[model samples]
Target: MDTNSKIKRLTILITCIILSTISYGQTSIKNINLKAGKYKVGFKHYTINDCTRTYRIHNDFNNQLIERPIPISIWYPSKIENNSSKQLTVLNYLEILKEEEEWNDLPNYFLLDWFPYLWNTPENKAHLSEKVTAFSNSYFLIGNFPVIVYAPSYQASSIENFALFEYLASNGFVIISSPSRGTETRWLEGGSSKDMETQSRDVEVLLKEINKYENIDVDRIALMGFSFGGLSNVITVMKNKNVSAIVSLDGTERYNYAILEKSPFFNLEKFSVPYIHFAQKEIPEEVLNSDKIPAELNYKFQLYDSLKYSEAYSFRFHDLSHSYFSSFGVLFANRDQRQDKSDDKIMVSYKLMSEHTLQFLNAVLKNEKNAKEYIENSPVKNGFSESLFSKKMKQAVTKEFDYKDFNDLALDQGYQNLIPLYKRTIAIHPNLELQEGMLNTLGLRLSFNPKKLEQGVNVFLLALYIYPKSANLYDSLAEGYFYNNDFENAISNYKKSLVLNPENQNAINRLKQLQE
Candidate 1:
């Protein structure tokens, strides 16, 4: 063979090997199948006067009447005979408004007659809409499952931002989405807090109304919310004990604090239900810091405490903004002429965030024990520990806490026992700063005692405080929270790390597992 030919053949062989390895490593989640399509769902719209008018009533900034419309869309697995086929169109009213405002240079209220029909376009037909159609259509369905109560953002419309909803429904989760009435349009216009109380009550009433539907496992009901909607879920679950679990997508902690203190879920001592918080890394610092405010004076602070009882997980995307978790964020960032740059970094972050959110829902809501491994043992980039002990030692000690102890203690005792050592290490080496050597030492320990998770979490948090910008630290903290059964906190901390480093496959895999 000629020299050039041999060289070309070798290059081709190398490329093939690389591609094969990539494909092998990029395996999707097992036992779960997802396909894009639409399904017919039974839905009902109602207006309720039972709850107070606006949210954040005490805030002088939100002084407005509570009267507004409430619309609810419920989805359940149905026999073909029970319902007709329908095309689904996922709409984002907020995105539409932003687009119209930018394109036409008109007031935000300038209504576009073509807005509703836009989903009918060939390019957008794959999306799911709440509206029904005359013909039966292909709808994605994983397996027959019970019902899930879904809450939309305070101002979002029905079928708005179906990214999360459709993914869940297609993967066997029945969803009921409640839209904020007049609040959708004015929410970003400085009127969101006004009708929150009414919004929460509306969600509860919808749950009661949805009970009339056939084949719904009301006892297995779970609450899933996004952004403002997530805040509503926090409120709804606090008032209604029937909710089994909750999944919040980048939901702020401020609203949770408010409801936990003055609203019905105030007595955290009384509630012990499992919950998951799926937050984005770019969550406003103000919201996370809400807990720092005095609980007596800040209603949101109380809600932060309530989060302690739930399994929390945060998905961080270094290249993503606060709105990235929602479909609107994806669409908005992808648009042309917008200064916001969307690249491979943003796309990967979105995927990672979505996957983690699903993994969490599966573990906490569906009670899938195997799913826990994703959070428990999954490795973040650079050999960062997925447990707390490694994190604490990485932050505090000049040398790594020997894994000999980790494996020995984890097997003999439990993760809880390691907390004191981690705490003491932090106290003793207050001046310790994270370094490559420390990380390597911690990695060695984690390799042996991966289950000594609490100590790993403490170490990770301490490392985070010292190296606040380290994505590895945040990922470790997230893993710490996950093993601790604090899914909400796990999601929150993971998000912080992701925001700093989105390409971390370890974080992405763990996030996907949590979401599933």
Candidate 2:
């Protein structure tokens, strides 16, 4: 690029900064000029109730399920309330440490216990919660908007990443977040994996409720979790197909925990979607705590490599620690000599984190061609060198389902000629989980195109061949048959499904509908 091009790009960014400042009213927040978006933002809370789960750690024994109140916080585009609306109060570690359990009762044996010593005694953040561009419970903007469900790191508040949430919301996305609840960092007695599993389950319940909102487009949803929260997010999205993308910020480091005892299948097996993980530079082996590196990091590396059929991106920022991923990191910095990095440095990293995240999520969820180009073409951002970046497009070889290639054929020509392709693909890449994701996408696409009902049936039939005993596939095939107006085949497949798995009430109900 020429000097003129460089000058033009800088001018555009500077203009954006100035306009954002003008709209949001210049902030009193020091050392940061974080950019806002096109729309004024609004924030509100949704208190979720009727959650029944009995954890052994809550008491000594697991009993009947009890109601749990999970509070979900939301940020969205709204009519500007006034120029003076301050950003919400920020939550700090000390307050979180006092939430439910006594401070002494929390674990202290870990290496992290020493790190907390570096924090300046938590001060009241009210003075620090300066100007930002958002309203308090303003009327939401009309139209169905894309959604981002965020998960905070262990022991952190949902408000930990408020900067990112508000920014994404300002850019016209619905952002939802919830407290970690049972899995909170207040106590580590509840195993890391167990807490994550609890949070993961909470995410499912939260998304179900978020979908009920009138303005949210259920089809476009993404999951983002910072630090250990990323682990929870990866776990949730692997189970919930409704999530279309994921952004993990310095997320891979949490793989050090073995809550699931190294069994990747439960959390990693079906990772066939658009996922990007931004990480801090790797720690030197000499400086590593143990004599060896954690096994889980290697597992994640293997999984990233195996995400051959998905749009996978991984990058390591030149100089950043794990905490730099969220806004809280900046507030926590420079507390003591032991923590020498200044808040301004972390703020720089956090700003980029917020910016890149919005861009990446925009690329996948909104299908913006230029956003994808920006991600692929511009790997390194100015000042902060993106030390390492890699993107794996699904290899088009056989036995492995090439999602991009197969999706093209399915949409352009139809699923009629796709079975042979899948057969060869499955033969080469015989991962049941990946195959399941492909089939599910095919089923969803088929449902949208009612005229392609028979094609849907054929696709499900191919899946049945791959997973012959899967009751769910039979039911899906039955639905496809019914959609095509083939009542007889529909009933037959539903009966087959019921015979294989008697508990599928959905299949039973569909069967009754056909019979009646």
Candidate 3:
């Protein structure tokens, strides 16, 4: 060959090898394939009222309706109608997110210094969202699909769980998620517990709003939450009988358990729903010491132990943290924080979790015969191990604590008469997350009633007993007493509240009027 031709041949061979490597890398992410399901997916958003109550979520003790809107993101099976949406690349989501005002703080979470390295690696960057997303503004599929209403983790946006949500929606499920204002955990300051009610009520309002549209199988609804969202699932199921099942993704009810003096919304004796819990296995050498091990991990063991009910299953995945459960969580966190677990390994674990969640839904919602075994019988893979668990009963059971049962009591005997049940329920379960909210609602609801003024005073007194440190609760009590014409008692409560917090302006203002 001529010298020029020989040089060209060598260059061609090297170019082909580089292209082949890049192709292999692009084809898979981590070690798992996150390709979209058989059906095309559609996306939409709904801004709904917070709940059944006329009052919005952020209202203060005065019951003045402070309007806080809830923005919900929904995904569903879609037809092949073309529009403006192009098949997305992973980089596209990055660009879209950067332009979003709400997502401005997002890039800080993703270690930007490593972005160039990840960008250059075709395997990590190629065809990720391409395997997901759909035509913008596409209509929902004609037939009814089972619904999955999701609650995001602490301060987590609906977009954080986008990959998982898209997977379920494309697989013939209608999945929706809300920002769950007030209870975003970041908002849970001053040791306040009222946000638990706000979260459930927010979820309830979002579902009711979404169900007004077509293609939703309301009967097959399931509540799923990651981390603290798990506790949300627990509390929401108690109030709504329509929810068929619950999935907790390493749910952070453990953290809540650490701070709970007692539970007002939970009852071990009343445990009945079919549920599945995926727990990050306790760290090595921690043993079973409650003090030594993190309270969050220990609480899961507490819940699973005391919370034996029908068709409940628990699995433990070793070498995982609370963060790896979500794909976006992995992508956003500092890569160095992942303990050197490759993206592929993390992806594999996510696949297992998602598949098991699907199996759980099949077993409970669709009556699939072998779905239980598929989950409980799962063997250890990539440091994932299943904890031996037995179904609570041979068959699934109905809800144990019905909202109608409590509502009937509140409506029939008067709100004050319902106190015994709250006290008794908390007596049995100390992790009742919504105790404060429930009591506040009870006290304030009756306080405004002309016939129930004394009842309001009684309920407010009870709330004070439960939350002694809460200046707001004391302020609420004083207002209730003042309205009931019990000026002496009202003055006493105002003084007590001032002792706790001298700068309680509302209480201070009301106390001056009562004295005059």
Find the candidate with the highest lDDT and give its number: 2
Q: Candidate 1's residue-wise lDDT over 103-216, tens digit each?
A: 334443333333431222232332223232212233323343656676655455545544555555545566776665433333343213334555566678778866665555
Give the Cα error of residue 337 in candidate 3, in Å.
5.4
- The C-alpha stretches of model 1 lying farther than 4 A from their native spots are 1-69, 78-84, 89-144, 182-194, 254-265, 283-308, 332-344, 375-516
Task: Report the C-alpha lDDT of model 3 over 443-486, residue by residue, as the tens digit.
Answer: 77788676887777667766776677877777777777787788
Question: Which residue pairs of candidate 3 clash?
Answer: 25-123, 30-344, 31-344, 227-252, 262-430, 263-430, 263-431, 263-432, 264-432, 265-432
User: What's the lDDT for all of these models?
Assistant: 0.48, 0.62, 0.60
Please identify which of the two predictions, 1 or 2, would achieve the higher lDDT against the true structure: 2
Query: For candidate 1, what is the lDDT?
Result: 0.48
Residue 307 C-alpha lDDT in model 2:
56
Give TM-scores for every candidate, taking all chains together and pairing residue i with residue i. 0.48, 0.63, 0.59
Q: For model 2, give the 10-residue run with minimal summed lDDT.
A: 18-27
